[model samples]
Target: MTTIGIDDMALATAHHVVDLADLAAAAGVDPAKYRVGLGQDRFAFPAPDEDVVTMGAAAALPIVERHGAAGIRTLLFATESGVDQSKSAGLFVHGLLGLPPQMRVVELKQACYGGTAALQAAIGIVSRNPSERVLVVASDVARYELDSPGEPTQGAGAVAMLVAADPRLVEIEPVSGLSSAHVDDFWRPNDSSTAVVDGALSMSAYLSALTSAWDDFAAHGGAGIDEIDRFAFHQPFTKMARKALRRLATHTGAALDDVLQEATFAYNRELGNTYAASLYAGIAALLDGDDDLADRRIGLFSYGSGAVGELFTGVVRPGYDRVLRPGAVPDALAARVPLGLAEYRALHAVQHPSDVDLTTPSVTKAPFRFAGLRGRARQYERTA
Candidate 1:
């Protein structure tokens, strides 16, 4: 069997951020509730012109530019915040990145687990056809009603991964474990822009799914918790992930060391919840912070509300550190303009109208922007 896994990865976040302190002050709450209790410091917010497709393209463009898009045989876009009800966002991303038109393009939605599902499918394809390559992108804008309990967890970003044989970043193990249940931990109806979540129920569901998936994984001869060098979970928030890890540790009777815990959540603390993109962003964060991860094993736990869970393993390839683009994530995060309470509210209020003459906001400085609607079709353009 061909060794199939991630060849390269990249991330993109909105150029604007809202500090939790500002949000707390505006809500008449203590900052520690968000910063300490939730383990979130800041969250990214999109400009008027940014959405899942644009953000997905932004994250993928760099990979296509560096590796060339000619070899790509498939493109899978995973997101719940899709712009169209009929069309797949992958088509838009393929056009935006100038990828080969002959490739298979499709979209997947199982909430946040969609990305992991795409990755797993991509690996299967590549493993069968050694010459084929697949690009999987997970992008989302997590939103909730204003002043709601889920507000601080809202964020926008994307993560793109190129999967192929002899991958440079990591080698995905063929075996994986998955658990699924029909539950309403979180859901967004077709008519609603914001998601409805039962926080306590969601947390219970997440930890339960993690435990079941891990158990199934171990039953299938997967690595034990003690043997894994790093663990990455679908991060709705940092504290949630930490709680899940603690649960895992207790289940396995393995100690969850401070370094491992810190490495798992550093990015989620700053970026908040990115929905489909969170787990991969956590992987990228671990790679960015640790220089000695090459050849190490990583345990990945992916969960999506309404609800599905997967546990998988991958081994970092030698010299995997060199595959990460220097200053990509750091530069983007550093460039973000922190928003005050009023500015944040104003930004959030700017919505895309379906039948109006919408123009690109001058404030949108991201490489890719949603260029508004034309003939009821969503349009996007690359910034000059």
Candidate 2:
């Protein structure tokens, strides 16, 4: 019987940003088609020297520096954009952050739901071993073919969380409801670099899975929809989340207020979709943006393609404000270098070749970067 939850959290986005309006103009579509219709403004795009591992390490380094990594017993990385099939991305993060070698390191893949799965596993481990600390990092680069239907949702980022007993930010309630199905709403084949998504079907699947999980959660004595002080959803886009929340509110007879939806979607609109990192990023954004959320009940709904959904609740711990700095999220967003449509396409077109002994140019300004492929192994380095 231990109280386990998120102790500290941090996030990182690529230094490059692409405005949706520019994309719309290039595609011969109205700006409102992306800004108003889809509820997205811009999204982060990783440079040639950045990928999931580099972004993941960049996010985790701040947490490790603040909390110290000596006590961490488990490091779990979740992503759909893994650099290697066999090797865990957590290992790279461990090395970059200079963590102790004694901890268990592994990667989890369940699409966007992977992060929550890792978090739940960490909670279980910490409950069994009170002294153990777990670090869960979710990072991904959502890419689709150029001019494809799913291109506008593309984004790159990471979110890292340190989980332990008596957490300073939020305490997980342990009660959760989950639903899973073998649906090919979205997936990427082994040989394909970009994902194939059934947009309409994926939206349907997301809403359906969410409803099932929420229903099960309420049946198992979870909090009522109205009773929760805040709600955060795994956001592929702001409009998608808003639609799902409205549907959930209608089904449960709860009030779907504009203020709540706006609060939850504040980060998604700015960041686009981080795939596995989206949910945690939303939570971090909420913590950083609102000062009144302290000691409030917050509900989280996580959904992944091909497809899994989970509903869980946590209480925002007292002094949560001290764990996050005000304006930190906004400042990171503001620091990105804006990319024009042509510039974005050129950057996106650069792909790593399998046979060449290539070394990536020092394109990314971040401390951690993907050095390139040397002997078919993904090489990464920490910049001095």
Candidate 3:
């Protein structure tokens, strides 16, 4: 197999935010219950003009600008927050980013694991056709019932990657540890826009899948806990990843440090859970926040509710630090307009009509936005 992996990555989130403190105060709960207990400070929320399509396009635009879209022959979009069941979300992104028409456009879904599945597929495509490039974009808006236990965990974002031979960011090893089983951890029916979650069972499933994948990886002569330099995990709440590391430490007899969790999952806390995009967002945070990752090994575990898991590793490219746009993630995060409890609640509550022309104003300042629904078709546009 030829070497293949991410050449570049970009992160984008909804421009609206709500402090977890605001959420707690509105719910008549202690602020620390969210700030410290859930390990989230603030979370990004979509404006009426933003959704997974717009976010995914915004994230991928930078990658195309740097690498050029000519070599990209595959576009894999991973998401749980899909706009339409019949149409692949990749089609909207293809036009938005102006990728070539000859590409294979696909939309993948399996909850959070969708990102990993898209990435693996991209790797396979590039490995077969080393001269071609693949664009893998994972985006989602994690929504739950208002005033529910999962409310604070809700978030919106996207992570876009350019995959090709001799990648600048990292080189993915062909081997992976995998596990899957049916579990009533989380799901959303076609009739509803929100998820139904068994929080306790979901967390248990995540840990169990990680353990199984880790053991399988070890059995296949993968790295031991001591051999790995850092880790990235699918974080629904940032605290859950800390718990996962603790479990690994106990299982492998490794002495782990507390700072490691902060390094790996701090983005999840800031951005909240992004569903299919969650794990890749963690990886983006690791790559963006840390500078000493050059030539270091990164072990990653991905778990999706209902439930599938995989453990894989990648080696950071030499001079990988130079490939990223410095201060981009932080700048995008800082630029978010803070929302009051009422504004936030009202924004989440508004439902645009899909069967007719939409009257919602185009309000997002992002490069790409959902213009409206026109003639029962979702419409998106590039902003000036």
> lDDT per model, in order?
0.88, 0.89, 0.89
Judged by lDDT against the true structure, how good is candidate 2? 0.89
Q: Say which prediction, candidate 1 or candidate 2, comes out ahead on TM-score.
A: 2
TM-score of 3: 0.97
Model 2 CA deviation exceeding 4 Å by range: 258-261
Per-residue CA lDDT of candidate 3, range 208-231, in tens? Answer: 998899899999989777778888
Model 1 per-residue lDDT tens digits across residues 115-140? 99999999888877888899999999
lDDT, residue 260, model 3:
62
Structure candidate 1, residue pairs in collision: none
Candidate 2: tens digits of C-alpha lDDT, residues 1-384: 678999999888997999998999889999999888888899999888888999999899889889887779899999999888899999988888888879999999999999999999999999988898999999999999999989999988999999999999999997898899999999999988899999999999999999999989988999877778888889998788788878888888778674354666677787889999999888887787777877798889999999999999999999998888677777888888899888899988887777788888897778898888878888889887
TM-score against truth, every candidate: 0.97, 0.97, 0.97
Instruction: Report the number of clashing residue pairs per model.
Output: 0, 0, 0
Q: Give the poorly placed runs of model 1, Cα more than 4 Å off.
A: none
